[model samples]
Target: MRVVIAKCSVDYAGRLNAHLPLATRLLMLKGDGSVLIHSDGGSYKPLNWMSPPCSVSDVEVEQDQADAGITEIWKVVHHKTADMLVINIHEIFSDASHELGVDPGLIKDGVEAHLQKLLAEHIETLGEGYQLVRREYFTAIGPVDILARDENGGHVAVELKRRGDIDGVEQLTRYLELMNRDPLLAPVQGVFAAQEIKPQARTLAEDRGIRCVVLDYDALRGMADHNALF
Candidate 1:
């Protein structure tokens, strides 16, 4: 990964047009060929970012651009979408690179771990014909909580959370993206399961064609009646 602190202006073309005026910002050139531009604030989110499967190259600056204090230009073009992110650099304050080895991935808490086990034992909770493939099914990115197959033999990836949020939805989406790339799991579906799901999380999950399932912890544990009204 390479990090650069520079005074630059940004322009994005394709799908939409956006411009960021000249300012001092942090530019990240990731190992996966993604580029991100970030300001001093906004927490973890970059002000603008281009995801992986893209190429970045140094491009020549126009005479007028050079006259306006631009020293260099970096062009990022998406491989699939053809979206382009242009960075006009006036000055680079700092530039550095780091070699980050393979990530171990996030560890789930005790409750989530237990929930995964319960769901695996009762995979049919997802649907009548669902059968568990395995728990913690490993992928290049991370492990999905549960991998199952529907009645029609379609692959399904389940992401479990104690309280479902947008982040959880996004995580599952990444897992699904990677899993579906494999010929074996070309059509893997996603199930976001939690004890309680937030409205925003449900909306996003459904929008992405991922199913949302609310788990009854006690019932799954066989401690509560399934037919109880209260």
Candidate 2:
């Protein structure tokens, strides 16, 4: 995803970039006074840009304008491509808060704790001998969300996504490669767990001796009923 900052002051550019996802590609257009963001299947057009003392909503309006305009134009430019935009007004607000000397680390910590709790609870229920291991660590290709272990002493790596067209098969392949490298982890198997699994990914897993497990909100609720160790 490309995060386009238009007409932004030099002082704010670095601050804005810091809040973006590390994987996001950043583009800066100084003195243009407009912001445009482009991502999978959508684009955000140039919108209003104003300095501090502006209400959060006003800043969001500018972002929305950029998103709307850019997305429409992107669709026209590349009809075959998917151009999508996700505007987070709070991100700008957070930057402002940081500039004002407010510590946002507490809020971030709270959010992380909450998510970790959810993951721990669900993973614990996966079976009798499973445990939550590392999280957001790099494997062979990139960072994986979670790496778990079964009681039988097998390793399992898992990727979590709220939404997206991910290549789970290739992703799992990389995890398997990394796991096999570790003498202790070589005996473990790899599993791809998502809200939904693509057919191609499933086929790829089967061919490579990996397992693909789909788990949604509802599925998670009943996941413990099955004996995973067997």
Candidate 3:
């Protein structure tokens, strides 16, 4: 992993286009070749990032650029989508690299966790014959939100998000990728479930042969409570 704090600007072109004016920010090149441009604020989220399955190449610094304090230019291209993230470094404050091993991934919190529990109890919300196998199904990479069995006896791996975007779909895809590797879970299907799923996310999910589920918190809870009364 490499970290560089530099005064830089960014431009991203692909599914969407974004630009960040020149500013001092932290640029992270993760072990998986993902690039993240971060500001001091914004919690853990980066100001801009390029997801993995990418290749990053550096451009030689010309003498004129060096005189202007522009020391580096990085061009990142996505392998599958051909999206690009361009980062131009004007001034470097710090630069270092670390050898960080495997990652355990995130634990859902706040509304996301609550949503997971709700869906687990009411796995039927997923489909008529779906039965909850477990919640927080742990794996080497991370815990799947919910694991279940569909009517046909196939496994289903669900990912819950408050607002499902392209990131959420990508996340679930990761989980499915790992989970399906095991012979026991070889046929696992993915469900991108969230209260609201963005159109782009839905399209991505469908393209990957994954199902998209729009969760209704109020109705889900009310149905669970009503079922309890019976």
Candidate 4:
């Protein structure tokens, strides 16, 4: 990763138009060829970013640009989408690079953990004859949200998310890949369950032969009979 602190202005155009006026900002150039421009604040989100699968090239600045205090230009172009991002740089302050290595991964936040427990208690909500093998089943990569067996006795690996996004599906896919390697859990299936799932996520899950289940937190509780929650 390379980090550069410089006086720069950014312009992005594609789905929308955005501009960042001349200011000192932190620019990040990732090993994957992606670039991000960040301000001093705003948590972890950058002011502007070009995601991976893009190319970044240093374009020569015109004489007029140099006269206007612009010394360099960086142009980033997306491969598949053809999106573009241009940064006009005036002066450099600091530049450095470091190898951070692979991340350990993220953890569940908010009420997501509690929701997983509730789902385990009401495993039947998944479907008739669905039995919970265990919750937080251990795996080499990490814990699988819940491991179970469907009515047909096939191994079912489930991943629960508060808001199911593409990342949830990706996580489940990785788990399924690892579990299917075990002879005992061969032919494992995946199910993505969440309170709310994005349409794009559902489509991606379907494309990968994974099933999606939209969950109901309120339905986890019952009045007369506990099984009625299913």
Candidate 5:
């Protein structure tokens, strides 16, 4: 990981045009070829970012840029989308790189963990003709809660939560974005399932075309009672 604190201006050109005037900000370059520009605020969310399958290069600054107090130029380009994020540096406060090895990944809360297992076992509770493909469906970003096929054989990615919120919706959104890019799952859909869902989360999920499902823990466990009868 490379971290740099610098006074820079950012310009993004792709699906939309955006600009960040000159200011001191934190820049993170990860080994995965992703770049993020963050400010002192906004918590963990980056002000601007270029996801993986991208490249970053330090290019020579133009004469006019040099005259305008620009000391360096970094260009980040997405391989697939051809989107570009350019940063013009006026000065760098600090620059350092660290070798953080493999990560263990995220640990789910106990109830959340069980939710995934139960949802996978009773996959059809989502709807008739739903079939579970697998749990913890692997993607480059992270593991999706569950991957299944609908009646028409279309792929569906389910993200389970104990209490659905906006962050869960965003997480599912990222999964859908990455999964849909794969030729094998080009038309992947998403389901945000939880014991309770916030209105904001449901709104966001629906706006993104993701279906929301409220699970009944007791009912799900009731279905498991056949084992006791046996």
Candidate 6:
């Protein structure tokens, strides 16, 4: 089995559904951390059908069969071989940051630094030796923003959104659901960090025992800067 990773501009699930043939099986890993697998009936044609099928002028029936076989094989190979695969929007671009007119590496660096600072500050508040789990991939869900172990022996999952959009809460709820199912993550508390949160959403989170923190750009920047100085 061979694994191939392709960069796709569209959503991974949509791309796979369009490209994968009916006979091939497909497994989709979503950015919001959802997993789905599809199985198609096996093909009727055999391999090595590339030769001319009898008296055809400029058209080979064998070639058509071979093409179909190859296409199905490619899909099967891609699905079976990959243990875990991510199809993030960021991976679509050759120079993603540059495509967005920003330095990709710098942006990543800044985000990592900011995350580290946020983790440190919050861990201290929770008490000592809290470690940050970076790029932790969850089953069904791809990667969460941050996963941390609190000093008091609790798990913490944080999601960061730039805007104060209520729609974003749906994704966080999915993450929380996954965490609740995992034995290792059951002790986890979910936190939503965004610039602003809708009043209804805040109320909903509070009712559900989730923590929502709203921080403006300047406030977040100040926290990062403060963490750096200390």
Clashing pairs in 1: none
Between candidates 5 and 6, name the one with more favorable lDDT: 5
TM-score of 4: 0.53
Alpha carbon deviation, residue 4, candidate 5 (Å): 1.6
Please report, in order, the local distance difference test score of every candidate based on alpha carbons: 0.86, 0.45, 0.85, 0.85, 0.89, 0.47
Better of 1 and 3 by TM-score: 1
Best-matching candidate per TM-score? 5
Considering TM-score, where higher is better, how would the candidates rank from best to worst? 5, 1, 3, 4, 6, 2
lDDT (tens digit, per residue) of candidate 5 on 57-132: 9999889989999999999998987889999999999999999999887799888887788888889999999999
Off by over 4 Å in 5: 129-134, 137-143, 147-155, 173-189, 207-209, 224-230
Per-candidate TM vs. native? 0.65, 0.41, 0.55, 0.53, 0.79, 0.45
| Candidate 2 local lDDT, residue 132 | 81
lDDT leader: 5
Which regions of candidate 1 are displaced past 4 Å?
114-159, 164-193, 197-213, 221-230
**Candidate 5 clash pair list:** none
Give the alpha carbon lDDT tens digit for every residue of 95-142 in model 2: 111122432332224433444345656786456778888766454234
- Clashes (backbone N, CA, C under 3 Å), per candidate, total 0, 15, 0, 0, 0, 4
Q: What is the lDDT of residue 184 in candidate 5?
A: 65
* Cα-lDDT of candidate 3: 0.85
